[model samples]
Target chain A: MMSRKVRKYFSFTAFVLPAFLFYFSLSLLPTMQGLFYSFTNWHFMNPKYGFVGLQNFINIFTKDRYFVMALKNTFKLVAALVILQPLIALLLALMIEACAKWLQKIFRTVIFVPYMISTIVGTFMWSFVFRQVFTQIGSSIPLLGFLNQSWLSNVDLAFWSIIIVSLWHGTPLLMVIFLAGLAGVPVQLKEAAVIDGAKPSQVFWHIKLPLIFYSLTICMFLTIKDAFKSYEIVYALTGGGPGWATQVMTLNIFEEAFSGNYMFGYASAKAVVFLLIVLVFTVAQLLLMKRREVEL
Target chain B: MTRRITPLYVLNILLLTLLALIFLFPILIGFLNSFKSFQEIFLSTLSLPKSWSLDNYITVFQRIKLLRSTGNTAIVSALAIAGIVLFGAMAGYKLSRTRTKYSTVIFLLFISSMLVPFHAIMIPLYQMASKLQLKGHLPGLSVLYIGLGVSLSIFMFHGFTKSISREMEEAASIDGSSEFGTFFRIILPLLRPAMGTIIVQMFIWTWNDYLLPVLMLLDMRQFTIVLSVNTLFGEYGNQWNLILPALIMAVIPVIIIYIFFQRYIMQGVLEGAIKG
Candidate 1:
């Protein structure tokens, strides 16, 4: 028994120690340091620092317009994606599924191609399109003169531009999830619903919708998560632009840390707050959606 | 019923097609714009240029030391993938099979980390790296990559390895093989598919990553492809000719690698989506 215990203990450590050390030192250390620095007024340049309790959080709440705007924009984006985007994606998915088998893959590929591009690439593509091509198209067409707007440069338009581009890049992911969910839905149920003399709306509202409730919930979680971590596209497009109008939390944290004199501790506080917001949003979404998930 | 579905479907398809065209438009413009002279790219950024030229590619290649930067990126990414897969698999095997208090704790730590955004700790991390003198070099970059990548890599491996039988391990051990040899000869071979997927994923992420490279690589010489792309944004003239080509050239290798590993790479991502 002693020998058996020794053998297992040795083998486990041999397997786990190498990875545990690296992961702890690099990933866990940074996380812990973030927690520590959140309590201190630590700047990158100044090596020596004293602990400053809750001042950063207070400043952000009281004085920091940037953090306030970021919080507002993040919530706004989350609401839009969770509420509006999914409806559009679901419609697209249902339509495509009902459309035809022959063209099923064609639409899927067309929609999903955007998801493959990096955020930087996606934002860059839209910048070129909105600023150049959209302008050109708008200017060329006489009847559609009012439709053409400068999307990226204007503060009012930039937020929507980010949202639209996000939908363009991200809707396919929803479509894919919905497609997977749609495929999982048994065909026999629809036939049963039809035989029961139900109207199309009744059949859909009662049958197809309830079946893919899990998918909707998962998609909502993903959409919210992506919304909070919305970094690269916003950063690339306007640099939280037009005087901090579009600055989300990630942008605020980045600008706080790297762009100016490094308020490392202050940045840590902002990041923690951002993390808490994301956590609350995610947990709330999960709880809300989990109630709707129909058990098989 | 299907016939009645046609109109809505047709409208949807048409809308999607138009969207796809718009989606594809920027890259097309980027491609065409690359060939146009800087004067042409700026003057008629929207229209087709009368004369196509190789000046942009030529300029970027000459000015940016394109080959050297590519070599640096390739080497760093390759080493990163190698370390991530090997270490992730070993660690995953242990945690999945063994029932220990530490295993649960370690696994939870790794999994919970997937939610934390990198920016949260990036400054402290940079400070740590600076303190350790692991700054602006290949070894330093690869070490950082391993740290960032291992959690997800291990998670993937854990899921894949969990589906396998422990009987194989016992059989190999009874044949007088060392535990390391058992893993190397048997389990590693069986895990080829998942590991292949992880390799391609780790490679692409490490290669295309812009932020870490910029933050770490202080020297102009160590600039990766994305870093070099920013070099095109100069104070004067802003060299769209040079920049466009640099962007195109940067993506070319990525395109090639993806094409080669496209199937596995896609499955890898799909698999990772569930895990992530």
Candidate 2:
């Protein structure tokens, strides 16, 4: 009886081991390996590597201007996305909720179409829209002639262009998420508020906002994480070009390792820093939001 | 449910229509210019295609090997999703059912890795893949995805398995069913809702992934749809005649999937956002 109980407990391993094998070799082991590699000078071409300790991290902080620039650009994008993406998505969700049922479906479907398409595909299409279609529209409508500026080539404008494209590609899914949250707001609560002579906007602020606060936290978390990990839209749209004006951390780390730099060890260090920044921001956001959630 | 359509409601509809049009403008433009000749595209992208010709589509189809790449993508996505759902469900179910120190540690191991960005691990993963000779192969890439994907799938299933009652499994066991037999017969069927969410999410992520494929696939023939289209874009810079058509073709599959699985996809996204 004792042996049978022991054998029964061991049987659970059969269910868990297959998935664990793949995950350990590919995900968990590589993570530790990456941290280990960060402390060494592991060049892509060179087989031999030596421990470099804190040199790579120090250099990234003090020496590499490009890394610094990428850091700044990443923060800029994240800030914009965290603030603006949810705001737009929330407004869209609120408006869609106001529409008739059938119209709501059409609006939701149309807005989300861009999201279903890959970021690269959508970014490439927008590149055409910015270059050719903008010029055509600018020339045809004299009042809108300013739209003909070199959107991708210009440094300042290129950043905005990436933001515009990212928002276009990203906002719809958040909108759908917000729509779900809004749907969960109990109808009776709103009706009760309205019976008390609360206007629609007032009811929204008092009743709906508190109810959907959880979704707000989720959107904020998703936006911050996504903005930090953003690669495809910027990579395809500008290839981190216009003189690396739009480079983010992922693109920087990728180019360092692959695009002729071959600084695998140094890139690994950048990857570590990238991971830390994301972890800090997202974990902090979650903690903060969880506290706020309890308050409400 | 009937209510008066007030002025505020009219304003809402008008605003939603305008935003939706803005959302669809680039896609609509890409579709229109895909049918136009090169010079026509340059002349006025907003204008209708003069002839609605299929010449550019034919060229793009042949140039990018769209059919072949699409097949490759489909194969990769299918294999990866199958592995993820099976392995994820089994492990998630077992982990949720068990209560031991090792189980807690194992579950934490899977959950904690969800926060690590892929770029942080890409270099080491690539090196590991090369060492194992898993690089540059479709099945190997699917295996990598299974590894990368199983964490989230496990998390989802684990959360979902809690809501499933243990009575069925207990009953099956008392009826002389073996453990594996009970799991397959009792727990697996009860896991369908979680499976639907997992399958939809996994399919979209694997199908639309670009960076992983770009890193893993070496040969043009093995290239997925996005890779083929990207290759065309690189080789023919500013040649909208070729690029636009491929762009249009690349998005058609996802759009179709969205149309069919809109409810499931939206629910999956909502669940992922909230729980993940």
Candidate 3:
């Protein structure tokens, strides 16, 4: 029986081996090699790499202006995503649920559609809309001229532009998540709360929010992680330009490794730090949220 | 069930319709502009063209070689999705059923990887690709995408497979099915909905992917639709005619897929969002 069990285990391993091959080759092998390369100044275009212990990290911390700014910007973006996106999504989900049945799917479909488009393409389309259409619309309204600024060109407004785009693409799905969580909130519980003289807001704050915390936490994790690595949209829209004002970390790393010069090792160190930051947040979220999944 | 459509419900429907328009209007703008001549596209930025013309499409087809790029994208995306579904389900099922330290760690690793930004490793991955002589090869690019996408699909599949019954697999085994046979017979068939969900999502992601394809496929012949269309931005002068037509070509697949499989896509997204 024991030998048979071992044979069964081998069979199962065979079943998983194909995915493992792809995963290990592309994801693990490259990343592990990247960590190795970080210890050496392995320039991609050149062969003159030699071991340099903590120099790359030391240089990044000491000399890189963009690195420090990237960290601060990333954390700021993360804070905004963690706090605002899910809360707004939850509120929208509530409003949509109180809506008519026929209209709900339409709203859900519309909201999620942007999420499906190329983030780069979508941001570009929004650029045309932002630079031209929104300006045209904003200027027409009296005293709201503050909104009419050159959004993509402005250092101040560009980050907010990226944030708004992120929210627009992201919020719909979170809204849907909240809607699904709403489905799990027992009707009997809602009715009981109503009978016990709970107002709608009170019931929602006390009941629906607690039940939906799992979805909220997942949304928060995704939002923050995505915010950490926000590159493609910012890359496409600003090209990290109008004076590096909207330049995020990933873009900084990309330019460092590619266009500026081939500092592959330094880029890898930056990447490893990024990986660590993402790992810390992910682990923290899983620990915080997994306990609250409430297996039911 | 017997209630009439109230004023509030009417207002909600109107609001949703307006919002859906906002979602749809960009693609619609691209589509409309594609039909218009270059001059008209500029003159009337947002309006119906008087008549449809295929000149822009023909020009782009001749120039960018749309059919071949579409073919390459289709082949790569199909293979990648097939790999993800077949391999992701197997791995997900195994991890979900077993509770060993190693398997649990692997599962966590997969989950946490979703958090890690791809740009971090992109430079070195590109180097490795060059070294292995895998750059510009369709199969090589497909493999890279499969690796990148597996984490999310497997995370999803793992959650979905846990809801499958032990009794069903046991029944298959009792009837002379081996463990492999039982998994294939009982478990795989039961996972069609999830398989559909993951495949469509993978299709969208892999189809719209820009950065990897841009870096890898250095030749014009191997350009995916996105790579082809995005080159518009770099062209000396923005030929709205060529660019708009190319954008249409890139998006049509997704729109077609959306129309047919919106229900499945919505369900899949909702499952991903709420469950995991």
Candidate 4:
């Protein structure tokens, strides 16, 4: 009946309106306002401001030295993560898969413990290790004296420290994803490959790699997004210290708006630019990876 | 069946054990050092604690108001996650079951917003929070989290609802059950796995979130666990005894949660990554 149809439609509205209402006001509206604010000179404190058109964006590209440094650092970190995250994750997944069942579970659990810890906590713990514990060890054990360098103070080492800490915390989730992908690899296919006198390495190269390429794509995409958006690790660990040597884009944006300078409009522009870069990078990576996924 | 171990298997076990040790070294060191006095830690960061004392923990507990902040975190995470689950479930199930243009549009609206990272909107979000008087309010922050979190929750539920059949709802409707009754009594109970996955994922997220709380929580008493521990770093520079104990206390609960819900958490990670 028409009444039944009307009631059904009303139920759909009833179900959806609650979430939509919350999402629209807080998420979507803020995002849209951010986009609008990007074009205006909106300071956090000063109420009187005028339209700036593309001035904020132009300044970011040409004049903002800090922004450029942050951009360079973000790219460097993203590049490292894109390559190393998948490599280490896939390697660990393969290693775990080859283990006996119980060992696999234990190893997976142990590695994933870091990922469960808050990034702030994990990074702080690593900070102590890099700052105090490593130095102590290096002094006590002469052979390990190389570890005594100012890990978070020296410019180059600090960058790498961020990468190391990021990888330690990030790799496990991707490894688990890789594990899931590897689990889906048919036992029959691998067994068949082995029966055909294929070597272990050969089976991995010819069979397992292709089958898990989808997971590889997903991991790469996630890595790029996370790397570009990386904040807490660098923020809590180094505070972009030693003269902003390791400031990433997110940190740069936060500093621009909140830390000292209340340049809300300029920060909005930087944020928009950062968002565009993330979108372009992730979308491009997804496209590139999609083409290489082996059809089963 | 009895299986013969190979040289390769021996190598695998050794390599895995080594990697596991490397992964766990920081936490192990932190745990050991947390029990040490400041002077003891400074004397030898590598050595086992001279005395396994609870002094630092007790000091940290009082300093950070551990129970109060954790209770605050629990309140926020619980309220946000509950709203997300209930709202996401209802909307996602209905959208999946409905065959209408409006459903498609609404679904698209939810999914597309997932791409906007928090950084992009954080400035304006700060403004909105102040305007709405949600700033520095704990329950208000939870409401904001529900708003921020619902997109992904809805996305997951939408994907999950596809794997569920509509026949049960139809059966219930034929039996003259109200739609709300049918959903709450039937569809929801069957959505336990997806619910488990989201609950674990969101709990970890909301519990450990630092940036949002930092932005929203203005008062010291409003600090969540991570925020409280973060203050330790600033107030006690290189005071390893206090900082390490607080960090340990902050991190240990989530590890315990992970131990219990490891499967769901990992599954959620895989599902979220692949789907997103």
Candidate 5:
């Protein structure tokens, strides 16, 4: 007969083994291998490769202007999204909350519809608007004539075009999150503050904002991370084009490995750097935000 | 509170109504234009279509292999969700129940790697998939999803299991039920809410995902709706008549599912955000 401890161990093994095997093979192992490969001169065609310690990293920093441009563009997108998405979402959520009950549900559902669509589809849909619909409107209305700019082609305009598409695709979720956060803010607290002769804005500032600081942090973190890793929209809307105008970090890494030079090791190094940036920003934000979360 | 319609309230409603219209505008245009001939769309996009025609959708449906790609998507989603829900539940429940140091370490190992972005692991994963003969295959892609997805699933399950009582499992064990038997017969049914959340989340993710499938599946027959639609767009860049209908078709299934499960989807998003 088996000892009781042996049986317990066996059960644990049986339960955990399936998940661990897949996770290790697909996720953990690849991550470790990616790190290792970043230090080598690996190529798909060549069977053999040699360690070229730090060359990939050095090349990305010193030699590759497109990589540098992509990095800057990613940060720019993150900055724009981190500020704009939450602000718009929070405002819309507050408005929706204040609406009639039936209207609130209808508005929330309608607003979130775009988010349910695939990113590629949504981006394509917006591209049509930017290309055709806006031009039609621009020609018909004298007052809105400026609406006809080449949204996806001209470099400066393309950045904003990508941002607009990303915002449209991304904001609905944050709005829903903010709406959920708003629901958690007790009505009694707002009523109590109002009974004390506080203005609506004052009550919102003093009571509601603190109560939903946790949600704000979450929304901001999501926006930042998502914007930094922006791909499908940029890929569909502009193809990171009119010459790399909207290329973000993920697109850069993808092109490096797959599309352009097929430099797998070099792309892995960029991916590692990308991962570190994401980790640092996300961890720092979480730590800073967690401390500010109100107990109530 | 008095039911007074102040200027502030009027402005708020108007502003919100305008914003809501803007939010709906793109999809509205896409839907409207999908029924228009290319000439009609080019002539006047803002107006209602001159005549609502089924020609665009008919052509797109015939050309894009919508039914086949949708089936492929369904297959991938089903296999991935099944593996994720089953294995994630097993690991999560055991990790939560067992108090051993090893359990703690194993649980942490899964949890900590949740922060690694997919791009960081994409290159090596592609290499691994190729080496393992998983490249260019749908079932192989599903297995990769299980690996990439299990961490978050396990985390969710682990947290959920903590909220439920353990007495039932213990009693079943006392009555000479094997551990697997206890899990399957007793505990799995009890995890309905969590299973629902994970299944919906995984389905939406795997269905909408563009990058992974693009990397893994090289064959046209293996394309998901997103991949097929992307290919259609590339082939017919300026052909909005064809592309818009395909776009609408690509999103139709998800939108239908969303409408039916609106409440659950909203709750899942909020819960996932807060928990993660």
Candidate 6:
């Protein structure tokens, strides 16, 4: 007979093995292998490569101006999103919360409908608006003529166009999160504050916000992570144009590895850098936010 | 409270109404203009179409092979969800129950990789896919989805499994039920709420994902709806008529699912975000 300890171990293996195999092969192993490839001069065309020892990393920093620019653009986008999305979502959630019960459901559904659409399709739809509808509106309406600006083509405008679309696509989720947070804010506490002569703003500041701090952290975390990983919106809307003005790091990595040069090793190095940046920011954010999270 | 209309309330409602209109603007325009002829759309972009027409829809339906691509997407999503739910539940349950050092190490190994961005893994993953002859294959793609997706699902499952009592499992074991049978019968049924959340989360993610499929799948015959729509956009850059309808069609399925499962979808989002 098998020993009890052996049986326990066997059962554990039997249960976890399938998930581990797939996760290791596809997610874990590839990540480690990608890190290993970053130091080499691997290309898709040639099977042979030699260890270049941080050449790719050096190039990304010192030589590859595009990668640096992409990194800057990603940070810009993240900074914008980190500020705007949660604030707007919170404002909207507050408004919706103040509304009558039935109106809340209707408004919530309409707002969140955008989040249901695939990013590619949603971006394409926005492109159509920017290209055709805006131009038409500009020609007809004298006051709205500025709407006719080439949104996806002009370098300056293209960045804002991506920001606008990302906000549009991303805010609904945060809004819903804020709404959920709002639901957890005890009505009695707000009423008590009001009875104690606290104004609406005062009540919100003192009572509601503190209660929803956990949700705020989650929303901020999601927005930051998503902004760093922003791809499809930029890919579909701008294609990292006009002249790489809107290229985020993911797009840069993709173009480096797949689209043109097929520089797998170099791209892997950028990916590693990208991973490290994301990890640092996410870890720092979580650590910082977790401290402030209040228990009910 | 006074049953009277106040200026501030009026202002709030008007502002919210305006915001709602803005939120719905893109979808409204996409749907309305999908019926318009190109000339009509160009002439009055904001106005309703002169007459509702199905011409664009018909043309795009034929050009993009919308039905075939939708079928491929459904198959991919179903297979991936099946694998994710099954494997995630098994592993999460086992890991949550077992408190040994090995289990803790394995659990940590899975959880620590949760923040590793997909972009970091894409290149080598692509290489590995090619090497395994799994690139450009749908089943292979589904397996990859399972791989990429299971970590978070397992995390969710692990957290969820801790809430249920362990007495039932012990009783089942004592009643001569095998471990696998106990999980499948006793434990799995009790995990319905989590299962629902996982199914919704995985379905939307797999169904809506664009980047991985673009990298992995090559043939036009195997394109998902998003891939096919992207191709149509590239092929007909200036043809807004075709593009708009295709976008609408591509969006319709998810919208339908969302309408049906709005409550569950929202709950899933909140639960996943909070727990994750």
Docking class of 4: high
| Candidate rank order under DockQ | 2, 4, 5, 6, 3, 1
How good is the docking of model 6, by CAPRI class?
high
Q: What is the lDDT of residue B184 in candidate 3?
A: 77
Tell me the lDDT of model 5 at B246: 93
In model 1, the runs with Cα more than 4 Å from the true position are: A99-102, A191-204, B1-5, B234-239
Q: Which ten residues in a row have the lowest lDDT in candidate 2 chain B?
A: B1-10
Give a tens-digit lDDT track for model 6, residues A86-172.
999999999998887788899998899888888888988898888888888888899999997888889888988998899999999
For model 5, the stretches where C-alpha displacement exceeds 4 angstroms are B1-4
- For every model in order, the fraction of real contacts preserved is 0.41, 0.85, 0.52, 0.87, 0.85, 0.84
Error of 6 at B102 (Å): 1.0
TM-score of each: 0.91, 0.98, 0.90, 0.98, 0.98, 0.98
Provide all candidates' interface root-mean-square deviations. 2.4, 0.9, 2.5, 1.1, 1.1, 1.1
Cα lDDT tens digits, model 1, A1-296, are: 55987998898889878777778877889988888899889888897989889888899899998789898988887788777678878977877787567677666666665665555655665666676657766777888675378786788898888887788767877877788778777878887888889886887788888998988887887888888888877876777887888888888888889987599989999988887788788889889888878976
Q: All predictions: root-mean-square deviation over Cα?
A: 2.8, 1.3, 3.1, 1.4, 1.2, 1.2
List, in order, the clash count of every candidate structure.
Answer: 0, 0, 0, 0, 0, 0
In order, candidate lDDTs are 0.77, 0.91, 0.77, 0.90, 0.90, 0.91
State in Å the error of residue A296, model 5. Answer: 1.1
By lDDT, the better pick of 4 and 6 is 6
Q: How close to the true structure is residue B246 of candidate 2, measured as C-alpha lDDT?
A: 97
Stretches > 4 Å off in candidate 6: B1-4
TM-score of each model's chain B: 0.92, 0.98, 0.89, 0.96, 0.96, 0.97
B1-276 per-residue lDDT for model 4 (tens digits): 223698978988898899888889889999999999888888999888888889999999999999999999999999999999999899888888888888899899998878787899999999998988889979989989998999888888888899988898889999999999999999999888778777877888899899999999999998999999999898997999999999999987888888887887888777777876
Could you tell me the lDDT of residue A137 within candidate 2?
Answer: 89
Candidate 3 lDDT, A1-296, residue by residue in tens: 66987886797688667777777777777788778877888887678889999998998899988888877777877787778898878867876777756667767776777777777667656655566546654676667677678888988788888887777777777777788888788888888998999997999888887887777777777787777878777777777767877777888787878886878888889888888888888779878887876544
Best by DockQ: 2
Q: After superposition, how far is residue B177 of candidate 3 from its true place, in Å?
A: 4.4
Q: What is the per-residue lDDT of model 5 for residues B97-198, given as tens digits with 9 covering 90 to 100?
A: 999888999999999888888888999999999989898889999999999999999999999999989898879989999889989998999988888888
